[model samples]
Target: MLFKKLYTKSLFRICPKILSISSLRYATAPSSYAETVDLAYSSYESTEDETSVRPPVVILHGLLGSKNNWNSMSKAIHKSTGRKVISIDARNHGDSKHSSQHTYLHMAQDVIKLLKKLEISKVSLLGHSMGGRTAMVLSLLSSDLVSSLIVVDISPAKTSPQIFSMVNLFDAMAAVSLRSGIAMSKARKLADEQLKAVIPDINLRNFLITNLIQTNTGSYSWRVNIPALKENFQQNIASFPSSLKGLQYCGPTLFIGGSLSDYIGKNDLPEIQEYFPLAQLQFVDGAGHWVHSQKPEKFLEIACSFLKDK
Candidate 1:
């Protein structure tokens, strides 16, 4: 039954920009119209006295993920490298303010603003999936602000076919019913039933459902701005910008892929090297798209080594 539903969804495709008003009627209006997003973040600073010598690391999560996802990892990184770690909740995700517009340009700018606000002159950036793409764009747009870059399981070439599956998942989430004052358990049960029909993978479904939160009124809502994300899927998330084609970021860069994930393949190396001339690629065994989460030890080892290297 789930397979049949997924097959039917795969046949339905629509341009993200052409979303009708009815499609987004459930979404609330954005609080502001500013081009720059005011990002919310958490910091992990080293307890040792030598913290000043270690460069700060800024971590960005993927789509539908919040800074809280990186909490443990950030602490681990800080402990290992004795560096300050900042895990940011990108706009429209976690505690950050939602906006009608979401793009890599705006996301990258938001990161810059956060850095300035924190008085960080330069940082080592580590990003996963959508965040990886954001880091790449930011490195190219403002190379001076980034000392090093680590891109996890994502390429800047083009959108992978895997992204389309997310559309179906979002559609399923939007279809779930959640009246005010509904029990959290009941809401989750309802959402899971609807999501299971479209997303068969339990891990993915679990990850997506983390965005579901109980509103003050006791109704279920999503921490992420799903409507904005859905609307900008093709225009932003699904494609790399054409304007950045000729641009290059000549900093030390590492591209980490999961052996089981098709997000990054050998064929992608040329384009990656084209944009990041000093880039090196590596892969973690027995892992998928969520490489860091799946193989935390290996991911952290590689990450700390790369960041520590001069």
Candidate 2:
């Protein structure tokens, strides 16, 4: 819980601009990489590398989230599991390159490319929200490359109508203007005012604003590609592809849902099992959609226990 306490304390250090929230209902496209998306990633190696034998864990963050969001958790996982942990910035998010196309298939391919480029033969994947969908699709397309799949607070099925708050969040972010040379303070103030109407939760607002960065010119800019994401919002919020209907990942899988979150419900199990036949569903008591952040200790226990199983 040390990292959880530290994460909470760091939230108020400086005010920043907001990012998009989870909007989880849409359709998927065919599984083909029309273009290669350059994904950016960071790795955490075990302290005693010579003794480490666990399969590497690759983490994918949610919509509007970057590899940076998983920094603390990645370190913790590596320490506990003795496995190399790699966290990536999906295309158009964080330091990754922007592209005109944004779909689960495309994103899944991006992850595959990164793994291949790193020469990692197999990995255990952990993804949250939109990242969860990407992980599912990737497992279906390349089951050989995935050792285990852990989906956090998201289902393969269509999301509920309430998830559309992300659409409103995106529209609000797009409306904010960050003229060149503006101070970080003023930019954050303006952003807070605009985001307040759409996103009223202080903690959620803090989580989203972490994506805002101060440019070399003193103006604030989002680390995420806002315009591209907004334009391809529908694809980004899509469900696992229907094209993968008959394909099922027989590998060990886990679905961790937040007890207070409706993103993953009882109705979604059939669809989840249809693709992930070995999936085990668990809920984190007293947590919401951001389950890991809300209950880091419990999340870590569940994750490490699952990953360490032989």
Candidate 3:
């Protein structure tokens, strides 16, 4: 589903108010909050049992996924590590604001703003697919805020076929009309049938179609910017910068890829190391591109181990 627009002009949030380091204010909106706005987001703090003294872990979801997609993983990480977890809906996804521009730099800036607003001095980063790319850019742009980096089943590389497939799914979703009050069950059934040829997995089809929101006028539409994402699909799959020449993140870095997927491979290591010298690569057997969702427990085990430094 080509959800929110990549550059809808609703993504930028200007915070002109400068806060003194001594007076770190939590939950204070920036003075420039009045500028162009679209979706808003809130963090879900871990329960007392899952709370920890370590810096919070920020989780970013992939394309067509909101923070909700990380619910299971977030909860598990929290409980296992007792560290606070903040699952973020990167700009155009979930309940967050949508923007016309979906560039990696723009997406990274969104996370920075959110962290500043939350008064978070430092955070551990975890991202999947598109979110993984966003996290990588964030670490490069604002390395101070990041402690460790965990990438799930995605690399800083071009994904041509995957991009085309995503465009097709978005096209299919845009073509469907459920404005006449179709039941969720019926809508899901129809979505499954429509996407069956392209997305054979019933679970993934349902996951993407969940973005369908029933409007007051009874028309079903997606929360994502359809036109923007479909138009900028190529930009989304663009490679990460390989000229880090001297730049690098020394913190512990984990790269988890799917054995059955082409998202990461030996050929990508040079660039990966060039940017993140301490990065470690691992693979989840039998899993595909969506490694986190396909193998939640294994993903959790690796994540918790890293976060706990055990």
Segments of candidate 2 deviating more than 4 angstroms: 1-32, 50-52
Q: All models: lDDT?
A: 0.79, 0.77, 0.70
Model 2: residue 132 alpha-carbon error in angstroms = 0.6
Q: After superposition, how far is residue 180 of candidate 1 from its true place, in Å?
A: 3.3
- Alpha-carbon runs more than 4 Å astray in model 3: 1-52, 157-161, 241-246
Ten contiguous residues with the weakest lDDT in model 2: 3-12
Candidate 2: pairs in clash: none
Residue 124, candidate 1: Cα error in Å is 0.2
Q: Candidate 3: lDDT of 76? A: 79
* Per-residue lDDT of model 2, residues 1-310, tens digit only: 2212200011122222121121111122333334668899999984584224557999999999999989999999988888889999998899998987887878888898888888888899999998998898888767788899999989877684667667777777777677777767777777787788878987777777777788787767787777777777765564555555666677888888887888887567767776676677888888889998999999999899998883
- Model 1: runs farther than 4 Å from truth? 1-34, 49-51
The per-prediction tally of clashing pairs is 0, 0, 15
Better of 1 and 2 by TM-score: 1
- Measured on C-alpha atoms, candidate 3 has an lDDT of 0.70
